[model samples]
Target: MPTTEPARPAHHFVAGIGAGPANLSLAALGEDLLPGGLPLFERQPGPAWHPGLLGAHSRLQTSWVKDLVTLVDPRNRLSFLNYLVQTGRIYAFLNAQFDAIPRVEYARYLGWAASELGTVRYGTAIHEIRFADRFELVGADGPVATAEHLVLGLGTHPEVPPCLPPGGLPGVVLAERLDATLAGDSGATGGQVIVVGGGQTGAEAVLSLVRRGVRDIRWLGRRHWFAPLDDSPPANDFYRPAYQRFFHNLPDDVRHAYVGAQVLTSDGVSLETLQEIYRANYEGYLRDGRAPVMILPGRDVVRAGARDGVVTLWCRRASGGSERHTAHLVVLATGRRPAPLPLSAGLAELVELDGAGDPIVDHDYSIRWKHAPRHRIFVQNRGRLSHGLADPNLSLLPVRSAIILNTLLDRPAFTIRDEQVYTMWA
Candidate 1:
C-alpha cells in the first residue's frame, strides 16, 4: 500500500481574524463576491458583541440603519431590518417607536446574523499569522487554515489605566465587569464607588450603580464637563463617505487637528443617557438628603492604591491642586486601544511602520506591507487617525467594508454614493 501524504490545511479565498461587527460587515458584503463565504476565526465561544456592556436600558448611539450590511447593501439578507422581519419582530419593533434601538437588541441582531452567515468558526483563536506563498493562520495545534488575503477586525479590549496598581487592587474592575462585580456578594453595593473616565461607558456605569441603589457614587472625568454627543447634521456630515474621502486626502497635521476638534462627535455620552443620569441624581437627592451620583469633572486620576479593603485615588485637578478620594469599588471606563496584531516575528518584519511604530494603513485601510501587491492585510477599526473618526464607528461599517471589498476585488463592487452632502470641507 502506498503511504498517504499529510493532508493540506483548509484554504480560503480570504479570512478574517475577528468576528466582531467590522469583520461581520465585511463577511456580509463579501458573501456573494467570494466563491465560498469569507471564513472568520472568532475566539469567542459564540457570537457576542460587547455583551458585558449591554445594559438593560442601553441604546445604540448610531441609527439602526447602520447595521452590518445596510448602508452599502440594504438588500443584503443580513440587514437589521431583514433580521427583524425574519425573526418575526418587524411589527413589534416598529410598534415600539424607539428613537434608538436597545443595545441588547442590536447584540441579538448581530448574533442572529452570525448564525445565518454559517461561515464563522467559533472558539478558534488564531495564535500567529505567518506568511509564505499565502497567509497561514496558526492555531494552538498547528496551521488551521490558509488564506490569500486577511482582514483584521480584532476589536478593542477594556483599557486599564497606568495609575492602577501593578497587580490590580481588590474591588477595582473594568467597566465591563462592574455589573458582575455588583451582582456578586462583593460588598461593593454598600459603600462608596468611584467611576473613572468621562465617556459613555463611565456614564453607563454611573447610571447602573444609581439604579442599583448605590449611594455616594463619585463620577470622575477628565473633561471640564460631561458633554452630550454632537448628533447634529453638520457633525454627522463628518461621518459621511464624501467627508471620509476629503479627510483621507488632507495632510497628516491637518487630519490630526480635525480629529482632535471632532472628538465629541464620537466620544461624548448620549443625551438620553445624560438626562437619565441627571434625573436619577436629582430624584435620589429629593428622596434622600444627598445625591447618589456626584459628578466630578476635570479630574485626572494619577495614582491609585488600596488599603483596608478600600481603593484610594489621587486625582490631579485640571485647574489647580490634587484631591484624594476613597471608595470601596472603583470602575475604569477609560476608553480602549486596538488589539495588537498577532503576526509572526519574521512576518511582522515585512510590514512598514509609521513614526508612532503603528502599521501605516492607507486610505483603503490596507496596511503598507512588502507583499501588498498580491497579498493584502486590510484592517478595520484601526484607521481612525488615518481615515477619519468614522473608521472605528458603527455609522460607516458598511461603507468601510465596501471600500475594502472593492479594493480586494479591484473593482467598484458596491457604489458608495454620498451626493446629498451639503457641507463643504475646505
Candidate 2:
C-alpha cells in the first residue's frame, strides 16, 4: 500500500489544485520527471469527473486519443491504453466497434489513472491563494501548503442565463446536474421538457430525457441547424514545430483574433449521438404522424419564466417575429463559464490583468505579477484569450503540461529522472 506523506515544508516545487483532466495531465507528467514530487489538491472526496452530468448516454465530443497522459507520454504506464489493458477491456473495446467510447467509461478511466498516481489530497478545498516569499495555498483548515509554483485547474462553472430570474422554479433547472435533478421523477414520464442552447451538452440532455420516456420535448436554438466542428485531423505541422514558429511570430492582436474565431461554442454533435437522436426523432415522427420532439431553429429565447410547474418561454423568431410556448420542465443547457478565483487583496493588486480582468500570461502560462519574480503562479483554464483555441480543451493537455513542466524545471528539455519514474509507478 502506498503511504500518505504528512504535509511538511518543501523547497522549490510545483503545487496543483483541482485534479481535473488538465491538472491530472500535469500530475502524470510531473510524476516521470520530479522525484518526491509536487503536491496536488482536489476538493472532491474521491476521483469524480463531471459527477453532476454523468449520464449513461453521455459521450465525449473528441476521440479517445485525447486522454490525460497519452497525448504527452504514450509509453507512460498511466496511459488510457494501459488502463484498458489493466481493466481487461483492451480486447473487448477492440470488438465493441466504437470510434468514441461512452463518457462514463472515460470518467472511470480517469478514476483508475488517479488511483494509480495516488499523490493527490482529496476533500481539501483551497479557499484563497497568498503570494509572499513563495506561493501559499490557504484552505478552510488554514495554510495547507506552500510552494514555489502554483497551477490553477479549477474547471468551468455552470452559466445561468441573465434573462432568467435567480432562484429557479420547481420545474426549472440548469442542465449541469441533469441526472441528479431528474432522478426519481414520476412527473417526467409524460411531462413536456423545454431544453435551451444548441451545444453538445444540450443535445445530450434532450436525448437523455427522451430516452427516459419523456413524451413531449422541444429543442430551441438560435442557429438554423447544428454546426459541425472543424473535422480536419490533428494538423501536426501547425500544432507541432512549424505552427509554434508561426504563432510566436504573429502580432498579439492577430493571434487573439485568430483564436477567437475558432472558439468551440456549441460546435457540432458527435457522429454517434447525432445518429441516435436523428433516428429516434424520425421513427417517432413516422409512428405518431407528428414528431413528439420539436426542433425550433433560428430563434432566440428573449425571456423565460416558470410558475406553478409550468415554464412560459418567449422567443424571437428568425424572421423578426415572436412566439410563446409553455412546457412542464425547462432545462437550460446554456453551458459554462470560467470559475472565478477569490484572490486576496494584496495578491490581486500585484497580479496584472487586461481590461476584462483576465490575467496576462507568458508563453509558459505563468500569471505576470508586479511584485512576485521568483514565485510563479500559473493558470490552467483562465487563458482562453491569450493561449489560443486549445486553452481549456483536452486537445492541448500534453503540450501545456510540457510547457509548465519545462518552466518548473528551468530546463529547455525535460528528461525523466529514474527515481521519479519508480515513485510514480510504485
Candidate 3:
C-alpha cells in the first residue's frame, strides 16, 4: 500500500534519511527538541532490521548494553533493558545468565522502539537530497520533503569482489542477508559448499552450514586462521568522553591511521562463540572420519565460474601453488562499504570529504563544507574519523544522536530528556 501523501509543509525543522539505528537515535533525540516532531524517511517498507541475514544463531557481536539509547543516556526509556522489561523477559534473561542475546532479539527490540516513536516514514526512499537555502528531500513516491536540517544515516554498502561477475553466481550468496538468502534449502546438504573470507561473517556462515547438517563445507580465506579481534577491554577508553577530546586534537593523518588501526572490520564474535565453532568442527572431524570442512588459509581466489550446478573456484595458495576447487555453493563473507549519498552533483561538490571520499564532519556530526552554512545540513554516520572508533558501531548510537540533536537545535548545553533514561537499576 502507498503512504498517504502528507500535505507538504512550507518547511520542517529537521529531516533524516535511512531509519537505521543511528538515524533512529537522532530521531529519538529530536523528539525532545522538536515538540512538533521531526520527519524521518526510510527506504524499507517498515522497521525491518537486516531481514535478509536474520539468522537463527546470529547473535549481536556487541553487548546489548550498547543499544540505541543506553550508552549516551542510560535512563532513556527506549532502551534494550526497557524492551526486555516490557516483553516480560527481564527475569528470564537474567536467569539465562547470558551477556549477549541473539541478533534477532536485538532487531525486535529496535522494532519496538521504532513503533513507540511513530515518527518514521516507512517505504519512503529519498532519491536525491539537495541543499540550498533549505534542504530538499525528493521522495521516490511522494512529494518532496523540505527541512532546515538533514541527517544521512544511509548505512554501509556491501562489498563484493570484483572478480565475481555481476548478478552473482547461483548458489553463491554474499553473507549480507544470510537467513533470507539461505532460507529453505538446507545449506551444503546437496553437495560441497564453499565460504570465502576470514571475517566474523565468514566464520559464522561456516558454523551455520555445519549446524544445518551440511557436512560438506570448505572455508577459504586469504589469511591464516581467523584473526584475533582486539579483546583488550581497556581499548574502549577511546570511546569515552576524555579520549574523544584527545582524538579530536590529533592531526588528520594521525586520526585516520588511528581509526583504521582499531576499527573491527568483521563481526567481533564473543569468546564463547569462538570456542563453540572450534568444538563443533573438532568433534565432527573426530566422529565422522571425514573432514567435510577444510580451512584453506593463506589462499586467494583468482576467479570463479559456474557450470551445470557446479561452481569452480581457482585460487592461489601462499606456497606458490595453484589449486582449483568445486562446490555446490559459495558464500562471500566480505564486508560492506559506505553507502552513496543521494546528493546532487553541485551539492556534493560543496560537501568536503577525506581522501577516501568519506564526509568530513565537525564535532557536532554536521558535514563540514567551506561554503555550506552551519547547522543547515547535518550528517549522522559519515563522521567516523572525527567522532572516534565508535562512530559506526551500535555502541555510539546515543552519543551520535545526542550530538546531532544538540547541533540541530543550536544549543551548546542541551540536555536529553530524563524520561528516556534506562537506568542500570531499572
Candidate 4:
C-alpha cells in the first residue's frame, strides 16, 4: 500500500462580517450547507440589534413570521418559533396578541439565535478584508481569520446631515439617543425642542418627548404630511419575491424612479405609531392648554448651526420662502446610510462599482468582483438600488438568505416557493 499524506483543514468555507439580522439570517440558513461552517465575525461583544433604539413601546415594523429562518427554513433549529419554545415564551408571546412583536423581543430572539451558533466569533471586529490566495479578515490586533468566501452585512450607520451643526453640542443628539438624553436632561421639557425628519425614527422621537412631558416639540418634515406606512395588501406585494424579481429586470432609470415613488412603502411611520402620537398630542392639549407636538410638515431643514446653548435651524418651506427656528435642543432623525465595506485596496479594486459608486450586486446579492466565481463576496442590506428596497427589509430576509445559499451551493438547497401570484407587476 502506498503511503498517503494528510490534507490540511481550511479555516472556513465562508466568513460573514457583522452579525446583524441580514448576515445572521444567512448564517442560520447556510450553516449546515457550508463545510467547515460559515462563521460570523461580529464587532459587538454579543448579539445586540439596534440596542439604542430598543424602546420599551417600540415594535418591529415587520411580522414575527419574517424571522431569520422561518421564511426559508421553518424547520431550522434557529427559527424564531424554536427560540420562543425553547425559551418557554411561545405561549406568552402568542397570548400577547401583538400586531407586531416588540423590538426588544426581536433583539432577544437574535441574541438567542447567535448564542446557538457556536461558530460566531463575537468581539472580533475585522479591520479590512484583504484578498490574496483567499480572503483574510484582519482586525486591529492582527489577523483574525481567513476564508474561501466573504460576506459583508455591516448594515447601516446614523447619517448626520452636513446641514447639522458641529458635534459635542449638549442638546443635539441622534434619534437613537433621544430617550436616554431626555431622561437625564431636566429642563428640556419646558424648552423648545425641535426634531428634524419625518420618518419612523423621527415620529418615535417626537412620541418619546411627548411622553416625557415635553410641552413644546416641533416635528419638522420635508413631506406635505407625516405619511403613515403603506401596509396595505397590494402595497405589501411590492415586498414579495415576485416583485423583487420583476424589479431586478427593470432598467436602472426605471428601478431608481420606482424606488423613489414608493418611498412611503418602507420609510413611512407605522399607522399605529402615528395614531399614538396624535392621541398623545390630543391628551397633552386637554391636560394643559397647549398641544405638545407641533407637526410642521412641508418644511425642509436647509441649514443648522449650534452656538452657546441654542440650536438654530433654517428651513425652506415647500409653499415658498425660508423660515428659521431656534431651539434649546435639536434631535436629528434624518436617516441611516449603509456602513462602508471594509475591503482592502486590493479587494476593493477588484469589485465593480456602479454609476452611483455602489457595488454592483447581482441577483444572488453577491458583488460582481474579480474572483467571484471561486471566492464570492456577498453583500447584505447594501443593495437597495441594485436589489430593491426589500434587500434591507426583514420581510424577505430568509428568502434572500436562501437565494444566496442556493447560489453559493450551486443547487436548490432551499426550494423558494412564492406561489399564488395574483398581481401582474409590469
Q: Name the candidate that leads on TM-score.
A: 1
- Residue pairs clashing in model 2 are none
How accurate locally, in lDDT, is each candidate? 0.92, 0.74, 0.74, 0.87
lDDT of 2: 0.74
Instruction: Quote each prediction's TM-score.
Output: 0.98, 0.89, 0.89, 0.95
lDDT of 1 by residue, 199-293 (tens): 99999999999888899899999999999999998999998899999999999899999999999999999999999988987888798978899
Best candidate according to lDDT: 1
What CA root-mean-square deviation does each model show from the true structure? 1.2, 6.8, 5.3, 3.9
lDDT by residue for model 2 over 237-318, one digit each (tens)?
Answer: 2233234434555677887776655544315566566677778888888987766578777778888877787889899888
> For candidate 4, lDDT tens digit of each residue in 169-228?
656889888777777867767789999989999998888887777789999999999999
- On lDDT, the stronger of 1 and 3 is 1
Off by over 4 Å in 1: 1-6
Comparing candidate 1 with candidate 2, which one achieves the higher lDDT?
1
- Per-residue lDDT tens digits for candidate 3, residues 1-426, read 889976874478777888888877766656666745766789899888876566777677677887887766777788888899999999988998866688888888878888888988898888987766777888766456888677788888678877789888877787765555556664446678888877777878888778877778888887655665555655555545555556777888888898877765324445666676778878888999775577778888889899998899999898898899998788888777678889888788887787877777777677777555543567665667786777766766787677667666667534543342222210
